[model samples]
Target chain A: MDVFAFFNLNELAFGLSKLPMFPYFDMAHYIISVMSLREQPGALCVSQRSPLACWFSSMLYCFGGAVLSALMLADAPVAPLSNTTNLLLATLMWYLVFYCPLDVVYSLASLLPLRLVLTAMKEVTRTWKVLSGVSQAGSKYSDALFVMVAVGWAKGAGGGLISNFEQLVRGVWKPETNELLKMSYPTKVTLLGAVVFSLQQCRYLPIQTHHLTFIYTLFTVTNKTRMMLLGSSSHPLSSLESFLYK
Target chain B: MDVFAFFNLNELAFGLSKLPMFPYFDMAHYIISVMSLREQPGALCVSQRSPLACWFSSMLYCFGGAVLSALMLADAPVAPLSNTTNLLLATLMWYLVFYCPLDVVYSLASLLPLRLVLTAMKEVTRTWKVLSGVSQAGSKYSDALFVMVAVGWAKGAGGGLISNFEQLVRGVWKPETNELLKMSYPTKVTLLGAVVFSLQQCRYLPIQTHHLTFIYTLFTVTNKTRMMLLGSSSHPLSSLESFLYK
Candidate 1:
C-alpha cells in the first residue's frame, strides 16, 4: 500500500506494545503539574523546580535521539519510496503516542506555579551548560571519551557531505559531451539566475504555504473534473512534485 | 535520466552558477580537515609530528561546514539532490586539494621546525579550551547552540525512523486478507523482542555503515558479479560519522 497505511499499522502496533507501561503516564502527569508552576522556557532554572525539569528534558531529548538511531539500525527500509510522507507520518504518530506523555509532562512541569521554578530552571540550564563544556573541551584538546565520539562523528558527516557534493557534479557531465556546458540552455540559465538572485539577496524564496495549499487543492479538483470529462482511469499529466520524488 | 544523472546535473548547475568565487569548495576542505583532526583519538600527539598538517586540517574542517551551509542557502538544485553520496564527495574532494597546501604553509612558518610546530599546535589547541571556557562563563552559555542543533536534528531523524519502521512492518500484511492482530502478531512480537533486548542489554539497533553501503550499492549496481563484490565507490553514503560539507 501507500505510506500512510504502513504508518497506521506500525503506529497501532507500537501503541499496543506500550499498553503495559500505562502507569508511567501518571508520572508524566505529575511532572506536567510541576512544570505548570514554572515560567515559560524555564527548562533549567534550578532549586527543585529547575533540576527536575532540566534533568527530565535532557534525558528525554537524548533518549529520543538514541531511540531514533536504534530504530534505523533495526532494519528499517529508508528508500524514498513516496517522498518521505510515510516516514514523516509514522514518526509523528510515534511522537504523539509514545513520546507525547513525557513531553506533556515536561511541558506542564515547565509551566509550574512555583515562584522559584525559574531559579531552579536556571541552574538546570547551567548543568547542561557544564556537560557541553566537557564536550567542547574534548573536541578541542581531545581525550574526553564522549567528545571523541561526538567530534569524530561530526567530522565524518562534514567530510562526507563535501565529498559527495563534488562527485555529483562530476558525474553529471560526460567527459566527451561538453554536455556539462551544453545541457538545455534554458535550464542552465534558470539555475544560474536563481543562484545569483539568492546570493545577492541572501534570502529564502520559498513558495508560501498557503500558495502551495491552494495549488494542491486546485490540482486535485481539476484532476477530478478531468476524470469526469474523460470518463477514464488515465491521468492527463503527472504532478511535478510527485514526478520529482519518484 | 536516472538518480545519478539527476544528482550530477543538480551539482554541476549549482557549482557553475556560483563560479569565480567558489567559496564553498574552499570552506568544505578546511572544515572537514579540522573536524577530523579534532576527533582523531590522539590528534594532539599526532600534531607533534606535523604542526602545519594540524593547522591545515583544522582550517579545512571549519571551512567545509561553512561552505555547505552557504551552499544550502543558495537557490540551486543542489539542495534537492544532496543525498548521502554527494555529501561525501564534496568533503573528500576538499581534503584532497587543500591538505598538502596547508601542510606546506604550516611547515614554512614554523621557526624551530618540529619542536616549534608542536609548541604552536599546543598553543592552538589551548585556544579551543579558552573558547569553551568563554562559552561556559557564569550566565552566558553559548555551547548549547551546537549541541541543541545536533541533538534536535537527531531527534527529528529518530522520530522519522520510528514511524517509518512501523509502516514497513504493517506493509508486510495483505490488508484485505488479514486482520490487524493476525498481521501484528509477528510484528508485535518482534518489536517486543527488540524492546526487551534494548532495555536489558542497553543495545539500540539502527543500521550502520555496512547497511547503508549495502542499500546504496544495491541501488547503483545491476549484475550478479556486482552482487559478489564489495568495493568502495569513489563516493559513498553519508553517515553520522561523516561531515556535513562532505
Candidate 2:
C-alpha cells in the first residue's frame, strides 16, 4: 500500500498546489544569483571572463526566477488567469525543471531539506559539470549534447500529446488529473533531461561510446516503454516508445 | 509563392528522409567534435579534461542518433502502425527540431543548406561556450543557467501536447498534417532552445545583471505571449497561454 501510493502521480501531485513558502524559495534563489563569488585560481587555472557575461548571467537569473515565480504562483491567486499566463508558466516550468537543476543544489540551503520537493529538486542539483576546459569544441559539444537530450525529450512529449489528445483533454478537465498532468510532465522532462546528461557524462567513465549508445538505446526503449505501459504517460516518447514496444 | 513555400513545414520536411548520406554526415560531426576551436578565452581560460570525458562525448552522438532513428522509423516497417510509435515519433520530432539544430549545422555541409533549417541551425552554432577553466563554483553556476532554459522549454512543449491533444490526434490521423506536426514541433523546440541559449549567452556582453533581469522578465512575458498567440502552438505554454490570451 505504501509503495503503491508513491507511484500514484495524482495523489503525489494533489499537494503541489499548496506548496509552502514559495516567496522564501524564490528569495533564497534571488540572493544567490545577485551575489557573485569567485574562487581562488590555481596556477593551472586560467581566468577568462566575458565582458558581456554579466548580461547573460543576470537575465538567466531573472528569467529563471520568473519561471519559478510562475510555478509558485500556480497555487497562488492570479486572478483572471489568461491563456497567455498559462502558456508562459508552462514554458517557464518546462525550461526550469529540466535545466535549472544543473545549478539548483549548489544554491539550496541545507536547513530546508524538504523531502516532498526533493524528488524534483534533487534532480536540479544532481548534475554538476566537473569544470575543466578541454577546448571550445568540448564546451560547445557539451552544450550541444544537452540540447540533443532536451530536444529529444521534447520531441517525444510533443508527439505523444498530438496522438493522444483525448486522454489529455479528459485529464485536463478533471481537477486532480489535470494537476497531475501539469506537474508530472515537467517531472518527467526533468528526469529525462537528467538521464540524457548522465548518459553523456557516462562517456567520461571509459566505456566505448557506441556500446553506451546501444545500452542507451535499450534504456531509451525500456524507459519509454515503461512510461507508456505503466503511468498515465505524460510525455510522447514514453507513451509512444511503450506503444511501439508492445 | 516560393517565399510562401519556404515557410511551409511540409515543403521543408519533405526531403529530410532522403538525406543523401548519413555516414558522411556523422563522420564530419566526429571530426568537428574532436577538433577544438577557440573564440576568446581571455579573462580565464581553463582546461580540465577528465579521462571520462570521452565517454560522455560519444554517447550523446548515439542518443541523438537513437532519437533521430526512432523518428525516422515512425513510418517504416514497424508493423501494426500502433499509437505508441506515433506518440514517440512526435515527441522525438519536437525535441529534435528544437534542439537538434545546434549539432546539425556543423555536420550538414553544403549540400542541404535548406534555408529554413539553416535559420535554426545557425543559432545553435552561434551560441557557443567560450571555454576556459572557471573555478568549480563558476563552471557549476554556468551549468545551472543552461539547465534553466532547457527545463523551461521541456515544460512548455510537454504541456503543449497535453493540452492540445485533440488537434494532435487529428493531425496524427492525417498524413500531411502529421508530417507538418512532426516537422514543425521540432522546429519550434529548436527555435525556443536557441532563444533560451542566446538570452543566457547575453551575460557575456558586459551589461549589468539587474538591468538584464528587468529586461528579461519583461521579454519573457512578451515572448511567451507572442508564442501563445501565433501559430499552431506545439508547446503547452503557447497553447495554454494562447487559450488564456484569447
Candidate 3:
C-alpha cells in the first residue's frame, strides 16, 4: 500500500463533497450575523432592543448574501426569502444567539472548538457559492470573465459588502465601515478564488472544481486555525501578504 | 399545517439521529482531551516537553475511556487500540491541538461557536454511550440494574475516572485531584443520565431512546449554554441544585 495515497487531496475532497453542507453553512452564517450585529456601534444592547428590530436586522444580515446573489442573477430580490423553513430556522437561530436568556447560545457559539468547525464549514460554503456564482453567470454571459468574477465575488462576500446597507436598515449609518475600506480575509480570499474560478470557467485555467475546493479548504483551514490560536490582534496571513506584495 | 408540529421533539431527535455523529464526537472528545491534559499541574509546558512524552500522555488521555470500558466488559485492555486508522486520527488530532506551532489548533478549537457545537456533540455522544452501556449490561446480567448503571456510568465518564491513572502514566501522581474529589458537570450528568437510562432499560421508566435523547439534549444544551454565557465561575445548575436539595 502506498503511504502517500492515504493523504490524497482528491480523495479527501471527494469525501468532503459528500457531506451535507447547508446546515453547517446556515449555522455558521447566523453566528457570524449575530457577531457582526453586536459589533455595530449604533446597535442597541440586547436588553434595550425590540424583538422585532432584532429579528429584522439579523434576518437581513443572515440572508444578505443569498438575496444579493438572487438579485444579481435572477433579477428577483425575494427569491431567497420564499423558503418558509429556511426563514423560520434563520429566525430561530438569530433569536437564540442574540436574545436567549443569559446569552447562552452566543457564549457557547463563541467557544473555540465550535467556532473553528463553524469557520471551516463557512469557508467550504463560500467556495461552493463562488463556484456556483461563476457557473451561473457563465451560463448567461458565456465568455464574460469580468462579469462572472464579479458575480462570483458577490455570491461569496455579498453579506460583508452589504454591511453598510444592513446597518442602515438597522437605522445606523457608518459609511466608513464599508467592506471595501477594510476587506476581511474571507472577502479577499473570495475575490481571489472568484478570479481563479472565472479563469477556469473561461478555459484560461484547467483545474477541476474539486481540486480548487481542496486547495481552498487547505488554505482557509490553515489561516483560520492560525487566526484562532494567535488571537484576533495578530494577523494570521500578514507575513504571507507582505511577502506577496513586497 | 399545525405550527406546534414544527417544534416536535421526536421529529427533532429523529433529524438529529440521522446526522453523522462519530466525527463530531471524535473531534469534541479530542478537544476535551487536549484541554484536560493542559490543565494537569504535573504536565510540562508544550515548549519544554519531549514529542514522545507528549504523544504518550495525549494518546493515553484520548483513549483512556475506550480502554477502561474494554477492560470492564471485554476483559481486553488493548482491544480499542486495534484499529490503526482510529489511532492515527487520534494521534494526528492530539498533535495538532497540543503541539502545533503557535498553538493555532488549540486557539481555534477554543472559540465559542466551534466549542458550542463540539460540546453539544459531546453531550449527544455521551447520551448514546450511556444508553449503549445500559443495554449491553442488561443483555448479560438480565436483572442487575445497579450493574447496568455502573457500566453505563463507566462508559460515559470513564475518561475522567481514569485521569489519575493517566497522570500517573505521565509521571505525575496526584491522588487529591481525582475525579471523585472534583467531579465535573459532565461526570455528574453522566452518572445521573446512566441511572436514568438504566431505569428505562429495566422497564421502570416508560420512555424511548429518542425521547431520552431529546430530554438529555435539552437539559445539556440549556445548562451548557448558561455555563458558557455566565462564565465558569457561575454554577449554571447551582440554583437548581439548591432548590432541589432544600
Candidate 4:
C-alpha cells in the first residue's frame, strides 16, 4: 500500500520529467566536476564550500522532491506523454523508490544505528572472506557459490517491488489471479531490478567524484604498495600454522 | 589476506586503554553530525522549502548521529583484555572493515546517479505487481515468489559488503574460497536480520508512532468481527460462480 501510494502520485511525472531534468539542467555534469574539486586541498577547509558539490546535491534533492510531489499528486496532470519518456521516467522513478530510501536508511544507520549496520556488514564480509579462502584451495562449487551470491544480490534488489505489488494486487484484483502473476519471470526481473538498484545504491559513492577518487587513490597506491612490498612475509608463521593444521 | 589484515588490527588492540582516541572525540562527532544534519534535511524533504520538515529531520539526524557515535565507541577504548571482548571487538571491527566502506559506493549510485536508481525501482515494482496478481490461487511454490523477493532484497542489502570484500580480497586470496564465504549461513542470517530491521524501522514510524492507537483499534475490531462472522457464511462462498467456475 505504501509503495503504491508512493508511486501513485510520483510515478508518471517522476519517470518522464523530473528525473531527466537534472542532466538537461547540467546539474549532473557540474556535480561531476564539483565533486572532483571537493577532494582538492583546502576546498572544504576554505570558508566557502565547493559550489559545484552544493549545487549538484541540492539540485538533485530538489529534483527528487519534485518527483516525490508528483507521486503525491492526486490527479494526473493532462500532458502529452511518449513511450520513450514513459520508459525513461519509469526507470528513474523506480530506481529512487528502490535505492534512494535505503541510502537514507543506511545514512541514518551510520549516524544512529551504526553498530547494527556495521555488525551486519561485518558478517557478510567475514562469510565472503572465509569462502574465498576455501575456494583458493580449489574447492568444488566455488563458481556456483559466486553465482549464487551475484544472483541472490540481484534478486534482493528487486524484492521490494515484488513485496509492494503483492500488497497492491490484493487491493486491486481478485486474489486467485494474483497468485498466478507471482511466478512469472518478467515480474521477477522488474522486482529484482528495483531491489538491486536500491541495495546497490546503498553501498557506494559515485566514481569520478573527488572524495571517491582520493580514497581509491590512497588505497590503491598506499596499502597496495605496502602489501606488495611485504607480500605474505609480514604475517607470522604461527598464523600460517593454524591454517595448515586446521 | 584482507580478513587476516583486519583481524590483525583487532588482535593488536587487546586492551580498552589501547583503543584509538581520535574517533571517539566529541568535537569530531559534533562537527560531522552538524554538517550531515544540515545536508540531510534538505536532502530528505519532499519539497525545497519545507523548512519545518527540514528542522524536524535535522533533529532526527542529530539524534541518529549521537546514537551511532556512542555505539561506535561502545566497544572502543577496547574492553580490558578478555577473550570475549576480543572476539566481540574482532568481530565488530572485522565487520566494519568489510562492509562500511561500501556505503560510500552505494550512496554514489543513489545520489549522483539518481536516474539509474529511480528507473530500477520502478521496473521492480511493475514486475512485482504483475507477478503478485498472477500468483493468486497458484501452487505452493507460487507463494515462494514472495520469499524469493524477500531473499533478493536481503542480498541487495548485503551486497555492498560482498562486493567490497570481493574487491579487497581479489589481490590477496584465491577466488574459490572467496565465493564459499559469500553464501554461508552466517551471511544469510546477517542478511535476514538486515531485512527484518529495515522493514521494522521503516514501519515503526507509520504503524507505531503516528498511528499508535489506530493499529490497536483495527486489531481489536477485526478480530471480534471475524469471529462473529465466521459461522454466518453457509459454505464460506457468497456466490456459486466463484467455487463452481474454478
Best by TM-score: 3
Q: Write the per-residue lDDT of candidate 3 for residues B202-231, one digit (tens) a residue.
A: 889887766676677678767777787667
Fnat of candidate 3, please? 0.00
Considering the two chains of model 4, state its CAPRI-style docking category.
incorrect
What is the iRMSD in Å for candidate 2? 19.6
Where does candidate 1 stray beyond 4 Å? A1-72, A75-246, B1-28, B31-44, B49-103, B107-246
Misplaced by over 4 Å in model 4 are A1-20, A23-246, B1-172, B175-182, B204-246
DockQ of model 2 vs. true complex:
0.02
lDDT top scorer = 3
Question: A68, model 2: CA deviation in Å?
Answer: 16
What's the lDDT for residue A184 in model 2?
43
- Evaluate every candidate with DockQ and list the scores: 0.02, 0.02, 0.01, 0.01
Please give the lDDT score for candidate 2.
0.31
TM-score per prediction, in order, is: 0.21, 0.22, 0.47, 0.16
lDDT for each of the candidates? 0.31, 0.31, 0.71, 0.29
Point out the higher-scoring one by lDDT: 2 or 3. Answer: 3
lDDT of 2 by residue, A1-246 (tens): 333246663343334323342334333333333222111122011112332233223323323322222222221223213436433443343333223565463345212333223322222221211111111112333433333333233222322222122222222222222211232443354345444543455354454333333333334444444454565555565666459546
- Taking the tens digit of each residue's C-alpha lDDT, what string does model 3 give over A179-230? 7888888788888889999998898887666666677767766777778777
RMSD of each: 26.9, 24.9, 27.1, 31.2
CA displacement after TM-score superposition, residue A6 of candidate 2 (Å)? 6.9
Query: Candidate 4: global Cα-lDDT?
Result: 0.29
Candidate chain B TM-scores, in order? 0.19, 0.22, 0.86, 0.19
Candidate 2, residues B1-246, lDDT tens digits: the string is 343247663333334323332334333323332221111121011112211122222222222222222222221111111223332433343233223556463244322333223333222221121111111113334555444344333322322222232222112122244323543543354335434443544355454333332333334334434443563444555676469869
Model 4, span A12-69: residue lDDT tens = 4233222223233232222222332233344343213222223222222222222222
